[model samples]
Target chain A: MNLVQISLATGFLLILLGLYGALTNRDILRMIVSFTIADTGVNVVLVAVGYLPGREAPILDTIPVAEAASRITDPVPQALVLTAIVIGLGVTALMLAYAYRLFRARGSLDISEFTELKW
Target chain B: MNFTTRKAIPLVLLLLLGSVFYALFAGYTPDETLNRSASYYASQTVQDTGAQNVVTAIIVTYRGLDTLGEVTVLFLTAAIVGLVLAHSKAPKGRSGSGFLPSGELLTTGTRMLVPVILLFGAYVFLNGHLTPGGGFQGGAIVASAMLLMLLSDSAERFSHRLISRIESSAGLTYVILGLLGMLFAGGFLDNRILPLGSFGSILSAGAIPLIYALIGLKVGAEFSSILTSLEATEDSQ
Candidate 1:
């Protein structure tokens, strides 16, 4: 299909792959990586959804200001994705910090090892 | 549960989810035009904010409060990482014992690249209103300099006090600027507190460049703090 559709498919496939990896992987670090993959997939989907058939980026540097609405793809999604990417990075860092602490405490990186919450 | 079932269950679930995604992909149709808010930003960015980049205008002006919250979240993440890793830190005297010295090439490359990276980051944030880059991207770039330094010299110790001071001061100034906007301009975080200036120049877009510069500093400091804290734990290993 079109570029947008291809990107959308790729995004969906990435999400699926990530989810599958997270579910199958027992290592905490692997799970974290899987989650990041899924996070990236979500971001891709968002950007793809914002894409127009044939439009310039939402910057007015090249395109005239008056024609922006018709000329540019939806900028809202790009802005939202920017925020998402940053937040995702913070979350990943926090997760890694927690994982390091966990590894230090228990000397294990396996997800099944930490079962404090399990009933 | 059994190992086979553990794997099988996820496979089954993903199969179902994949079908759902397939349906969504099939049904999805691209929009023909900008939605209301998108159009509003596309049109209003010139007269209202005088920023060449509509995304910067929206982030630094229209949605400033959200950006403030986002920065707070990063701060909290950095703080928590430091807190979490504090007890595991290596003693000060034994900092560089274990790791082999990084080669001369990496050391020299870092030395050569770091200042340029820092300057580029500053440039990106400073001209955010007129270009594609902004505070977050610039801040991340600045943090990458710290990353490079750490890689070259694993034992490189950063002054936490200095980093925290920069971070807190930038954050405080950002808030004060927001309040200044409320007092002087239309509302909180209004870029119009100063003149919007001539469009497309570095000085245009009122306080966006200034606010973004502050954001870049704060974000860079926070990311560097996080990186430093993580690096500190390396010596304990």
Candidate 2:
């Protein structure tokens, strides 16, 4: 397969692996880590979708500005991915904080241990 | 749930999801050329925003308001983390006092590398418009320095008030720059408030470098705040 296909497959596989780990794991920390892996997969897929087989990065530092459109890959997805990565980090940190609070509250990290919200 | 069902649920769900993904992968076709907005940015980045990095141009110029909101979200996360962990923070004067001493090599290495890391982070954000690195990447690098310090020295106590000050001021300045863009140039957060200087140079890209520098500081502060909040939890143990 080509570079795009290979990367796309890798990204999807990572997402699946992360999802399986998250769903099967009982520990809150493990779930957080699994979700981070999934988040990384999403970023990789976005970047792969924006990839052009035979093109340079979308930076004008090296390439001539006049030929940028033909020479560079798409910058939109990359920009979106950058934002997504940062927001993902923020979300992970928030989740970690919540987990810490939960542990403090009940002295347990198991997801099943906290059933206050369960219907 | 029963043990068999618990194990089988994820497997069955994954199978269904995997099939969906397979269909998407089979049907997917890479585009030969840029889409409408991507093409616009590719062709017009240098002329419009004076940023050599088109991604930087899009993040800081074309989608500046979104960036502002992203920073706000980071700020909120940091604040909430601090608030949530505040009760567990070690009492004053008792923080960072009880841990075993870090070895000489780590301490010396961290001391030597921290300054260089801080400088590199500043350089990355300052040269954001000209290079692949930008505010977010630079800010993360800055936070790494803080992480290193915390790791190497158990007794190292960061001034929380100072970090918050930097974060607040940087965020405030970023918004002001956006307002300035509205007043002096095009719409909000336009980088053309100052003259788009000579291309490929550090000084080019108008207000991009300035705005990115502020973002770097703000992000760095937020990350450091989060790190300290987590680190201080060791005292609760």
Off by over 4 Å in 1: B93-99, B154-157, B234-237
User: How good is the docking of model 2, by CAPRI class?
Assistant: high
Steric clash pairs (candidate 2): none
- Would you estimate the TM-scores of all the predictions? 0.96, 0.96
Interface RMSD of each: 0.8, 0.7
* lDDT, candidate 2, A1-119, per-residue tens: 99999999999999999999999999999999999999999899999999988999988877999999999999999999998999899899999999988998999999999999998
RMSD of 1: 1.7
Cα misplacement distance, residue B53 of candidate 1 (Å) = 0.7
Residues B1-237, candidate 2: write the lDDT tens digits: 789998998999999999999999999999998888889999999889888999999999999999999999999999998988888777654545245666899889998999999999999999889888999999999999998887775334557788899999999999999999999999899999999989888998999999999999999999998988887665456
Global lDDT of each candidate = 0.90, 0.91
lDDT of 1 at A35: 97
Off by over 4 Å in 2: B93-100, B154-157, B234-237
